[model samples]
Target: MSQPQADEGIQTSIDELGLPLSETTFVVLDLETTGTSATDARITEIGAVRVRGGETVDEFTTLVNPGIAIPATVTLLTGITQSMVATAPPVEEVLPDLLEYLRRDPGTALVAHNASFDTGFLKAACERHGHPWPAPPVVDTLRLARAVLGRGETRNHKLGTLAAFFGTPVTPNHRALDDARATVDVLHGLVERLGPMGVHSLEELRSVTKPPTKQQIAKRHLAEGVPEAPGVYVFTDANGADLYVGKSKNLRHRVRTYFTAAENRQRIREMARVVEGVTPIVCATELEASVRELRLIAERKPPYNRRSRHPERVHWVKLTTEAFPRLSVVRSVKDDGAPYLGPYTGLKEADRAREALLAAFPLRQCTHTFDPPRRTVEPCVLAQLGRCGAPCDGTESRADYTAHADAAREAMTGDPAAVVDLHTARIRKMSAQLRYEEAAALRDRLAAFLRGAGRSQRLTALAVLPQVIATRPGALGWETGVVRHGRLAASAVLRPGTDPAAFLASLEATAEHVEPGPGPVPRATAAEGELVLDWLTDPATRLVRIEGEWTCPLRSAEAHAEMTHWAHGRAPAQ
Candidate 1:
């Protein structure tokens, strides 16, 4: 590798360099593949120009028999007919010859117009032949041209366009040799434009524009169809292995949103390139979609998807069993013997609830601890305060403690509205009778009910637990995207209709199924919480109705049943 330098001898080799350039050499290559994708397409042509020490020392260009009929679209693009490459040297025969010519002396880096596309084809071809190219840095002249000439000067950076701009002409046709020559001229002009010392070396040129990679095309994108179907969808490769899973109500529309509206091109491109196919499953309802989504995430555990390893790490409270049972907070849900109340966020909060119930109205902390044989340690603080309706005193009956324990547990989970009404009535009676403590207890109970009521939501019956729910309102219907973590695993599209065929279609289309779970409860007060409640309870809530694609839920009994199973778990086996 050599370049013309100051005080250099007047020689043909250095003179042929076309400029006083750097020692770095470049291998410019081109290919005609059977298709746009490297993996699915075969290469039919190979062309290259090797420049060492700024001199075009060698050239390699040939048509390779790709062993397959070149698609017409590619033929039109490259003009290498299926017949032209049919009898040419096979890739195995020519690749060796091509490599030897290009890699003989000081190794030169690869160069191409749209490097990502060419590299993809070459990589796929080489990998298929079991002879991968060595990892070499790339020098993209397209980028060099763009930088040397402002973007405003040219709309497209093709060789002929640049050649015309610089007035360095080529006489041969659009063959590999001619294109490579034209490209070299473009490179020379760029170096001159940048100035000899301007771009110190070819290495500096490579530094400017890195080669391309697989890019998601803009063809499949549909800008307006986001918030698509509320069912589940699974993305897969050609091998049918699940790459990712998701649920959406508007099936067709939501898939398009990723390709169209998603802001992250890198992520979308990865998803699009890897997603060779899609699997869609319509759920009975949105709730079922949620359940299905979780099931898919947990089951598939696709590479990109993640979530909390232990659900209870978030916190909760549980009620354990005993004659004088304790109401305590548990950090994790375990296979403990008694029915549990929650898995709550803070022990301090749990303690506050405990004190509220005990000081004003004392109850036992533990049933087992107060047992006759002294179950464990000495009875705790409850026994000291007369707070314990204790079995330790041998006076507390199992039935009496059991009733009080059940009442407290019910106060936590049972319908707070019903409890609120009861407490309100009792408080009024106490107030009227002038019994302050009684009225005060009833007032506290009523307040607790009101707070709990804020957490409740009445979703349509097709809902379930152990799932995440997302909603998208469409012209035809509500589209729900059910997901767990970030990957889509399953979905359901429930339309309002009586058509049994459509109903069954919706059920069968479900991506993956999950056990239904309750809707998320409000953890804090905000307009968002109020908004969700209003949307749920609003009688006028409506979805845009699409014709044959989806029907309204109002007209379909099958959708109703599907929605119920989705919201609630499937009926207990028999």
Candidate 2:
């Protein structure tokens, strides 16, 4: 089915009634969907190739928010995520914009693969978003595929296999807009071979988008042939440069629709300018297509691809058992295994918590703020109120002061055993001194040990392990997934591969500890681990790698509770 590029698909009728060689405008539209049923699924990406006569022109591509979280598989297939789309101007915002662009001529025809899916997505998106649905003149090469290639030409009429059989040059397959553009190439080839239709006028081509006659509908299905059986396809330029990529169940029909639409002027124009080829890959199922598309996009980072552009980067507060410790903030997790705070949004948020520690705990204000005596008099206001365990005045013994500093450091940094050790030490000292009141306080804090250690459930899992975390790769966002037992989970989101040992180390001060030989057998997924081992074991090694992600996970009760709290307004820091 092909519709006019506008509500009307009247191409310019010229001298001798010839198609506009460079003026017969057409839009090649493509849709990225949730599933096979265009009626039930939402569109994630929309691209179209514009063409005039036989010359390609321009292109239009956009990632839609879909008003829902993209499935992990879908994200993998299209590289379209909930966040990439979060700020994406909505479809309603773009549809009108597209309409205005197409209305430039007011009579161009619209084309798409299986035109129904893209058109369906368009219709639904318009209706759902409070926009009017207009019928535009359209064209479908799916009809051409059947008529030109005939019913018994191939076992299946897949866009790729068909292109391959017909000798169309396409490679690096399957992306929404890319495939739509490629289908145009196929359509042109077919039309060239088959000659003009019975109704050769632009009006005749425009009639394709309207409700087809029963005979036409039957013929349309036959032309659609065996649905491509769900797969991914890629659209490329004449030089094989990727312009767009896409996926669908029936590649033949889906690819065919784009060649027939008229509203696809922008896309058609873009494709005409850059595209000269296509590539398609059939998947075992729709799910496979979605998954493969995402991975391919993520890896390739195509010119038109979006998402993971700026991976999540966070500022962290470091808490260490090292000397002169209080609370220090940095931009990333540190190395040296001292256990630091976060990859948070900013220093201000971390500062809020730092203030709480200074007010509530009797910890040293500064390591050397009083060194050499800056005031020459009092220990400033901190010592006056006993808030400072007194590094400011030089009155407190180093032994006693540093001990309290260590304990405070423990609390601020969220060290689990640190709580246990502090509690035990305080209890022992109080017992010797007969200070039962202080000892009891330590006991209560110990009971809340698990509460503090829990840290509001970073767990992304159900009653399971944490999963679905985000990380940064240099300046890009990446997501890593894990499987605990048989259940899938996303775990430990980080940035830039988590290989910056110095960066992670900066988050915390390390206590100079001597290791007892080469530690136990290592079984951790750490970039540091990979780098260090490679450096030491084989100095010649030039390669090292890391990973990260962010998403809802199947985690333990503790983590699930935390994420739930965060998603709502009940977060701990809040």
lDDT of each: 0.51, 0.48
- Model 1 is weakest, by summed lDDT over 10 consecutive residues, at 565-574
Tens-digit lDDT track of model 2 for 201-274: 44344333332232222222222333455677676766777766667766765554444332244444345345
Which candidate ranks first by TM-score, i.e. highest?
1
Model 2 lDDT vs. the true structure?
A: 0.48
Quote the positional error of residue 122 for candidate 2 in Å: 0.6
lDDT string for model 1 (1-574, tens) is 8965643211123211222236667787766667777776666777788876657877788877765567777777678786787567666556657666656654456777667787777666555433547545555677677767886887677777787887767732446667777777777777777664344544335434431122333324322333344678777777988877766656765564344222133554566777666677766555556556665775677654544112334443455655577666555444454433322334544443344344433466654555445554455676777777655555566787777667655544443333444545555676567675566554443332222222221221222122344445444555444332222333344446646456435533664553333333222112223333344335644322211221122312222222321111111110
TM-score of each: 0.34, 0.33
Q: What is the lDDT of residue 549 in candidate 2?
A: 36
Candidate 2 residue runs with Cα over 4 Å from true position: 1-23, 38-40, 196-200, 203-574
